[model samples]
Target: MPMSITLPGPAPWGFRITGGRDFGKPITVSKVTEQGKAAMGDLRPGDIIVTINGESAAEMLNVEAQNKIKQSPGQLRLQVERWVLMGHLCNVNLVIPNRPLAPQNCRCLHPKPIPLHPNPSLAPRPRRCSHPCSSHPAPPPIPGALMLPSPPGPVR
Candidate 1:
């Protein structure tokens, strides 16, 4: 589900939307000015812009999206898709007997292509609980999932 975010307008909405001129690329929220006009509006980096002022963003080029943002009247209404790291890319099953906790064969579940971070760090292999009671190791992480802040703590 896309979220609708409205911010007071005029020039300098305090955020920027960026995407390549490539036809299928997504118009993503590239940057947000901290403590600026858009900061309090609940906008975040990497949110995909779906519509601008009720106009389909997919129909416009990157330049057009920039123009629409700059031309907002009183308020800027944007429909954006938030990116979810977990439960977005693939399904993970930790208990694969005789094999690595996470396998590289997981398939991308999304039909539309999502943009990745410009520089993604490789995630370390998941840790298995040495406690004998736990039969399986931790679930494997996606390739660049090092961004995960902390473990979920004791999975049962």
Candidate 2:
């Protein structure tokens, strides 16, 4: 069964959303306020928003979707994909997983590698091959089977 929520205008939907790779991907529900319209409407974290006010949310940017929800004065319709768990007695309950946090900034924590120059002369030199076969001429091919090139040497 689908849920339709009617919320007051000019106010937020009371949920946090994270945008996808592009506007084409469905935005995920990152968090839902405890006493907000979203919680009252049964919106949960991890729900993949499908549509808003009959418009396809798959192609909507996070701000666009938020704008659409806010534009509606009296009512807002949201279609989302949620997970349901089935019980032994045939009862079903919506599962709200823990909200995912924004990715940590680790670039500053890690040591930066030496930057290479754009000029070819300043770039790192090609490693010299130590294998005898790499520098030596191929031996005479055997008659019976086709010969395939040897695989590259293993990494250090």
Candidate 3:
């Protein structure tokens, strides 16, 4: 089963890297706050975001392309981008929200337990030996429960 993680739930505020139009010129900005935090800042509506903290939006998007490489849901990371300053591209960084988590396979699936039974015959038996049937040989006779000895050897 897949589990959906709610936004603004456990992760920090979202950060962004913006680029494109700026005073009829192209530029970028690596970081910006979400709507909630943006209201408390001096951010303008026309600002371009580029990244948050130290990671670029394109890099983050690449990381999210594969589910196995994505960070745990709600984890925060740094963003990075360029911004127009004094008619020059200025790189920046900001903290941002991590992508939400979709449903994942549950690890709790297991086989049902089997009930036990009472009594000797009803219970499990000892496993048989795995020796092959083609190796049968004559059985040796026991001498008073002790092994027989070899004949005496020649003197030196």
For model 3, residues 1-156, the per-residue Cα lDDT tens digits are 111112232333343333333233222223446574332332323333333333333433322322211342543332211111110011212111111112123222111111111232442322222233212111222222211111122100
Best by TM-score: 1
Higher lDDT: candidate 1 or 2? Answer: 1
How far in Å is the alpha carbon of 124 misplaced in model 3?
82
Each prediction's total of clashing residue pairs, residues at least 3 apart in sequence or on different chains, is 0, 0, 22
Give each model a TM-score: 0.55, 0.47, 0.20
Model 1 alpha-carbon drift over 4 Å, by segment: 20-23, 87-156
- Model 1 TM-score relative to the real fold: 0.55
Give all candidate RMSDs, comma-separated. 11.8, 22.9, 32.8
lDDT of 1 at 63: 87
Ranked by TM-score, the better of candidates 1 and 3 is: 1
1 or 2, which is superior by TM-score? Answer: 1
Tens-digit lDDT track of model 2 for 1-156: 233444554467788887754554567778899999888877777666777778777777778877777786667777775432211111212111221112122211111111112343543333322333232112222233211211122100
Q: Over 4 Å off in model 3, which ranges?
A: 1-9, 12-75, 87-156
* Residue 36 error, candidate 3, Å: 3.2
The global C-alpha lDDT for each of the candidates, from Candidate 1 onward, is 0.57, 0.48, 0.25
Better of 1 and 3 by lDDT: 1
